[model samples]
Target: MRITIANHKGGAGKTTATVNLAAALAELDKRVLVVDMDPQANASRRLARPFDRDAPQLTASEVVRSGEEGVAAQAIAPSGWPSPYTELVSVLPARFDLDNRVSEAGTVGAVGRLRRALQGVDDEYDYTLIDAQPSLGHLTQMAFAASQRVLVVVEPEYDSVEGALRVRDFVKGYAQDLGQPDLRVLAYLVNRARRVGEHAFQLEGLADRLEGDVWTPHIPEWTAAKDAASSALPLQICGSARGPEMATLWTELAKQIIVEGAA
Candidate 1:
């Protein structure tokens, strides 16, 4: 399945979810392709091999700009993670210049470029997760266009809840406009959740609002996530005290995704 992990609000933990979820899936012996659609390239930097000085020669920028069928095959590379994970997870890295695709949004068929580039390229992978930028802009549209479903991430708070709802509503209307009438929000993942009263209220409200679409076992606010990202390691091996707990949460979520995708 191809899923877009997205939010309209910055700092909603979109990249965090994407990277960790891919790691969790890898632990389950699944092959994953992470397509970094965000120009900030957090996912690429975290997952790509030689992310610093020896960057990828080809990236998602070239794939989308090429707009050619199966061009994504050329850009896909093993992730930076060690051994088994290096073999299980791959990334279509992105750089700062990926933002340039926004200027071509006005061109005919521009929205379908990424989708066209990815055709027949992901058949070997069990899942393809596209990490979109924190907006509903052209870049995000291309990500959405290339996805079969969306997993909306949000912090359990007012603005974040509003942003998730906006993404829900926007996908409903825009998917049809993009000629992807079947594309829909598969689930809402509550990230950075806390035990505070406001968070409790918002979690309840979001559940009531979205009904069965809200995923259970919300991801907690934890320093382990930050440490994992900064250290360029999966939560399973981040060595933080709570890293295993967080890794277990993501693994459970990955199992849920596998079941739902099969359904």
Candidate 2:
């Protein structure tokens, strides 16, 4: 299954979810690769940087900008997580240069270029998660074109929810214009939701408004999540605050993706 985790607004926990879910899937013996399409390279720093700072990188920018040549083969790198997770999880790191080259590289055939690039490694992993930049731009469109499903992560805030809704609507036009009419947001996930009454109300309201498309077991607000980001650890692997919750949530999300892929 190829899934794109996106949010047009920053600080919505897209990268956090990607790394944790990728770790969960990897623990399940599902070979996984996280394709960090975001030029911010935060995911790259968290998952890819800790392993090897000295190795030459093979970022997503190079693959997508390679045109028809299919350079994704060279872009794959092990996440270097130790023990059981070591070989199972890998990353396609990104760098600052990706952001710089976006204007020139994201032109005609941008979607096709990404599709072809990913096709080179399609058979190597059972699950591929594309972490999109926070926008409705060509990079995100290319991610949608390459993915079987979209996972939109939103925090339980007025502005974050609003941004997510706008992205939900934008995907429709993006799919049509990019020739991916079948593309759709398979899951709408609420992230970092506090256990307060107001937050609960907002989540319930979002579910009602979206006709029950909201995913089960929304991620709870936890300091461990922030710690994981800083320590370069997947939330599931942290084995600290809310670790079990993160583990189970991602496991269930992975199950949903498996069901969809089977369908």
TM-score per candidate: 0.97, 0.91
Backbone clash numbers for all candidates listed: 0, 0
lDDT of 1 at 129: 98
Query: Candidate 2 — which residues are off by over 4 angstroms?
Result: 50-54, 239-241
Model 1 lDDT per residue over 112-162, tens place:
999999999999999999999999999999989888899999898899888
230 in model 1: Cα distance from truth in Å? 0.3
Local distance difference test, each candidate: 0.90, 0.78
Q: Kindly give the stretch of ten consecutive residues in candidate 1 with the minimal lDDT sum.
A: 48-57
RMSD in angstroms, candidate 2?
2.1
Highest-scoring model, lDDT: 1
